[model samples]
Target: LSPSTGHRSIRTSSKPRPAKPCDPKSPCCRRSLTIDLDQSNNALDFVIYPRQFDIGECIGSCDTSGSSLQYTQAKNDQQKNKPHAAYNLVFLHHHGRNNNSLAATRNHRADKESSRCCSFSRTGGLELTYTTTVNGPIIKKYIPNMTVESCRCGLPATIQQV
Candidate 1:
């Protein structure tokens, strides 16, 4: 969230990271962000920020798609916004990756512009590919009693204490 006005995916022309051993399939684990959302109604509003703490490194630095981590970063090397590791999609999970049910959700402050979903709850979380660094304003549509599942590297799996 740098440049003061960063609300979308920003691309940069930086160099690629050199070949390193840390460069494996980047076999990462499942990292989840648990939020204390108490919506008495039937649904709740959710906001997922990129990185909430100093993940140090290797958090998103590896890939299993047979692709190497970018030599250069898409965003500035400011820890949170760093795109050394591609930011994957955030999935709206139910209990523990089962089917779904329930409401809708949205990213950022644009709630009115969000759409609705039925049957199951699955929202496309903030995904920053190698090309794009950070793209806020994601239309996260999910019901209540849900969580986020993202493919990430480093530290097995770290639950982001939101």
Candidate 2:
């Protein structure tokens, strides 16, 4: 991926050989910025409160508010100001700055291009970390998966899972 842009995500690269095969001058080995948000949880990697999402999985999942919310900046915000979009998931950030709600609303209107994305889920759930010989569709397993059920089985009559 380009350091300035998070595009060109390699799901899986060649297996680590005894020697480095990449040439710095080639586009394949171009400079890349590895954003390790989940690992380091750095501030720059997160969106400041003034530019946070109002209601979404990214912020609410943290279950924080106020000064606590300040500390709860979303790592997903980094993607917001980018000139390009991520391969699969796109994160839209809500403006949380101190200003009139009406103005803020207009500025960050949903119809705005910047507001468009896959979702506000900070995790984006792109498991771009797996290292193996596998690549492409096979690397999809890295992304987080969720299971849902409408009702419980073999339980009391009134008991329901959903």
Candidate 3:
């Protein structure tokens, strides 16, 4: 009878489990932006030319000479007297894992504030491209036309993206 008890134990097998659910707040499940820079097969020299005069109220200035630089007209009459130029500006933000962290949340707010203020005070123009992702599925893509204007007043009169 003891031997029968040992041999009569029940055994059952279960199907393999499915993949674990993705966390809504997980950084691993988030989307990211990819930037690709294509330079022709040529060795290029790089240089940053400083502004000879104050470039409105903004901290940066137009790169006077470069392969990737350009100039747009001032948005207003007051800005026409200043030197006009354009350059690529790269903004890098490092947000840690916590979605509620200050860097993650406040970066866009700060950029909005700066853009509003600079639009009012600056004479020169700038165009930027970058990527950001949030939990929401909403995606926004903006490609502004080449702007040429006097920066004193009014938005870019000739705003058209090409």
Clashing pairs in model 3?
73-148, 73-149, 74-149, 74-150, 75-149, 75-150, 75-151, 76-150, 145-160, 145-161
lDDT score at residue 143, model 3, on the 0-100 scale? 24
List model 1 lDDT by residue over 1-162, tens digit each.
457677643322121112133324444332333223242232333334222311122333332232322312311242454332223222222222442234322331332212111111121223222211245445423222122223343212333311
Q: Among these predicted structures, which one has the highest lDDT?
A: 1
Sort all candidates by TM-score, best to worst.
1, 3, 2
Predicted structure 2, TM vs. truth? 0.16
Q: Estimate each model's TM-score.
A: 0.21, 0.16, 0.17
lDDT of 3: 0.24
RMSD of each: 20.5, 20.3, 25.0
Please say which candidate is ahead in lDDT: 1 or 3: 1
Q: Which ten residues in a row have the lowest lDDT in candidate 2?
A: 147-156
Is 2 or 3 the stronger prediction by lDDT? 2
Off by over 4 Å in 2: 1-33, 36-100, 106-114, 119-162
Residue ranges of candidate 3 with Cα displaced over 4 Å:
1-84, 88-104, 119-147, 150-162
